[model samples]
Target: MRFTWAQRLTIAAAIAVAPMSAAHAWNESGHRIVARIAWDELTRPQQVFASELLVRHPRFAEDFAARMPPDIAARAADDPERQRWVFMHAAIWPDLLKAEGKRLSERIAALPAGAEKTELERRLADVKRYDNATWHYDNKPILIDPYALPPAAPPGAKPIGVQQALPNALRELDDRNLPAERRAVALAWVLHLLGDSHQPLHAVSLFSARHLPQGDLGGNVFFVVKPRPADPTPVRLHAVWDDMLGTDPKLEAATKRQIVAAFPRSRLKQELAEPADPPAVEAMVNLWLDESYRAADTSVYDANLRAALLAPLPAGATSALPVALDRRYLPAALPVARRRAALAGYRLADCIRRAESRSRP
Candidate 1:
């Protein structure tokens, strides 16, 4: 069946499972896909770095440790902080878990008919390297949406872009360089920041119901909906979005499948073909930022931004801003997170592919 432009847009947006919170959390499925892609293209050292960075699941983390060089493991083990860091890194990113499943299978496939654990361990470790030299902290402001109009300040207030905090963090990274061994850890920090920056609650400000009562501390102090359905209790709004970040992938996937099944093949094809490169990740980041800006630009989202804004807001709550707030148009934001994850994974793979291919010749 053919869908109208509005229908198609709505369908695509709905695939994402919006209405969810925007707090930062690890996205495992996304992490897995990315690791799988990166593992397929990257050599040993690169795979190790990428694998460690991707956090699809707990088993994958164990697999990573199992595959690491004994010497590197000993060094990591000796340093409790380093060992803990690796484990924490795995806990945060979901893609690594996804890749672990495939990473093990690939190894098993390459072995001789009766290859033993010793040979497998040797091959895996031979490819994995513990190089701290390759990573660096980039403090440069990676602008989410350079194109969006800057947010206006209230009568006497100063104007600030929603991307404020995370960009500042990134900028700091670019200001200093790290020695090679420490580079991987540095990358992890920036990666976390980038992910955090994309969350709308983290990106925007909130305030009281009326009379400009009080400012919400980036949603930290503002009381929004409570986590429980039966209670009218309140909690910080920021936490809501953060929790939504990784709430349920099975539900997210089910929603996406339903939406895509109805999606127009032509348009879906076009979207898939439009751009899938590293720059695309940058662009999508910008797009999400722009959408946030648009939502916050006026008292509310313009018709263009209305969909994104209303999609996530509580039902029946009117926007303080001028933009229309239609309850019927709410779209789930999970799909957006999923796509972002995929793009991040693909972009990471692309980066590693270029590096690995260069080493080949």
Candidate 2:
């Protein structure tokens, strides 16, 4: 039986709400690039519709408008430009929630049992419940050894992985019966997770007999040194991929424009040529995950770099030693990362279009 996008999305969402922890995929700049690309592709009417929905977000006033940079906030603009600004920033809302949730956790822990503490506790619960940081990646461990298979989840364990989360967000986005505020939050997650799913590191975890028996937590546990001389210190493998596009938060606007200009138009044209039907969309997501898994195994975890950087594992060691990426690794991986980002944008736009079409009267 063929499953409609709505049905698959429903199942995915139901599975994801069970609580599983994972890392965020692309950094803010990378997510912004995907958002900007998708935004540029959307029709004016579609953009307006999306912006209207976003404004319905419960915290839009405080989190978006009031928190806008002084210059933009002073203008008090509510035109399409202002709407687009809000829409683009929505892509990063999950990340923002993570920061807010952390501080809230600290505050809640410090507060005594009083009215103020009770109120803070309630808000903290909401933030934790809605925080999508863990929803960004699937921790399905990819065993490096070709002969070995990945470990199965324990019979009773329910880990809501990224593969499950994307469809859940999509289902939420398409549920017109739901409040616009709820749908808007889902839309933000859809945008963010689409970008996350395309990042190779986010889709797969490395497993080896000597090191990662369970998994590397999608490279979170696998530290790697930056190739740059100035920043030789070890960083998470996942973080390096997250910042592949660029790291400066202030540079998002310019970087968005630069990426748009530099994006291979032919490739983008090829990807957008045909949108996947509802039944096929989940398969498309799975396909993207598989492709990313292959990349992580072949390129990101190439043997040469592993040999150069990783120290010899001690007998009975449970983890691989942190390793430095070769100078050539970054240069080699950058193009692949850029291509994936561009493809994510095109695919996201397609998903948005499909959802809009299905929701139409």
Best by lDDT: 2
lDDT of 1 by residue, 25-89 (tens): 33443333333332344455555543343333223345455555566566743353344334334
| Model 2 lDDT per residue over 297-332, tens place | 788887865553245655554334445576788888
lDDT, each prediction: 0.38, 0.73
Backbone N/Cα/C clashes per model: 39, 0
Q: List runs of model 1 lying over 4 Å from the truth.
A: 1-45, 49-178, 207-215, 226-231, 248-288, 291-331, 348-361
TM-score of every model versus the real structure: 0.40, 0.84
